[model samples]
Target: MNYTAEAPAVWDPEAFTDAEDCLLCADQCVVRAQHYFVKGMIEIPVIGGDETFSWGVWVSISRDSFSRAADLWDTPGRESEKPSFGWLTTDLPVYPATTLNLKTYVHTRPVGERPFVELEPTDHPLAVEQRTGISLDRVREIAAAVLHAGEDAQR
Candidate 1:
């Protein structure tokens, strides 16, 4: 029942630098500390299995939502806050269609966990998987298709 898959590194170029305009860490990103974002778990249930297949992904959220999340970040019961609107900023290459800018509702989890990002119900395969879960075979297929494509180019 191992579910600790490696989350992809942030792909946005602005996050690559030590510049003052942006901040990108293991679990959060901020621009001018105003255009805020946080990495969250996009979990697709595994059909007939014990664990979910997940993508640790980032989303662009509003200033207000960001502020509220920061305020309650260390506080207990932070999970009670309403979900906030966000745009899926991560581009998952395994999908046939582009996965960026998709609508999402970001749910804050308790302290010590990433937020859960719920994709809007749509016909897109990724969104559908988020809503209805995916088969384990499909997860393997996706992993095989995209996981190693850029390794050589990076070096």
Candidate 2:
């Protein structure tokens, strides 16, 4: 039998930091897409009436994890809590499906000569319901925390 070695995956510098961050953690954990499994759901604040939304979470494997996804998912444990990768979003301040369309694959590079792969709103309802503006700020906060943690670890 013949086998081929896989190339190591490099994390996206835009989405991740040299230090620890949410994107970095997510990348290390192997989250490829922010999948919305459920529809029209929201998360509530501890004190405020403000609600958070969730479609669901999508976890994708890297070439590194391709052989391990089955083993990991099959084993006892929920994927979200121990997700391949994920991000939680709020229901309020939601971006209209029309407003937030993915023009190209922001997270991944093409395997061949393809310039870009665009995803439309109809392609998947949750695919276009991206969190932006303030929501993105929140995401950045989480990433900052992760980055801070990583820096602390180095010291």
Candidate 3:
């Protein structure tokens, strides 16, 4: 199933009520994907001393997404061996291509800047501000709650 990069909801301050939630969500979304789920994070140094990283996320069907994923997945000498983040479906014989592993190439922030600053997808007004230097208070607040929950070990 080929897919496209749909920016996730803006990181809500309230949505992340505690550190545990932040850590857990981030861990599940990225670290775990790389460490245990066979996905990988590849970093490439761009001209300006800035680096771009491909945090494999999903797959695509067209040149736009496919090209972007390909650029992110690019590495010297072993382009064909790069990982696949999504799959394409096709009808065929006994060994049809039923599955295609797609990888999400999440862009990293420019040097000394924050990542995802230009890609906020939500109705939250705070998200707008966040792109312009505002801190994510809602996420911090939720992170606090997550920590408390962990401390109490609620049922």
For this target, which candidate reaches the highest lDDT against the unseen true structure? 1
lDDT of 2: 0.29
Please provide TM-scores, in order, for all candidate models, with all chains considered together: 0.86, 0.22, 0.26
Using lDDT as the yardstick, the better of models 1 and 2 is: 1
- Residues 99-133, model 1: lDDT tens digits: 88889999999999899999999998889988888
Lowest lDDT block of 10, candidate 3 = 87-96
lDDT, candidate 3, 1-155, per-residue tens: 11112212222345444534342232122121221111122222223333332222222223443344335433433332333333222111111232233223233333322122122333333223223332245334434654675578565
What is the per-residue lDDT of model 2 for residues 1-155, given as tens digits with 9 covering 90 to 100? 11111111333455544434323332223223432211111121212224343222222234433334433433443232222222222221133343222232212222211111122334433343332212545444445654675688699
- lDDT for each candidate structure: 0.78, 0.29, 0.29
RMSD of each: 3.0, 17.4, 16.4
lDDT of 1: 0.78
For model 1, state the Cα shift of residue 129 in Å. Answer: 0.7
Q: Output the worst ten-in-a-row residue range by lDDT, candidate 1.
A: 1-10
Identify the runs in model 2 with alpha carbons over 4 angstroms from their true place.
1-52, 57-60, 77-155
Candidate 3 has a TM-score of 0.26
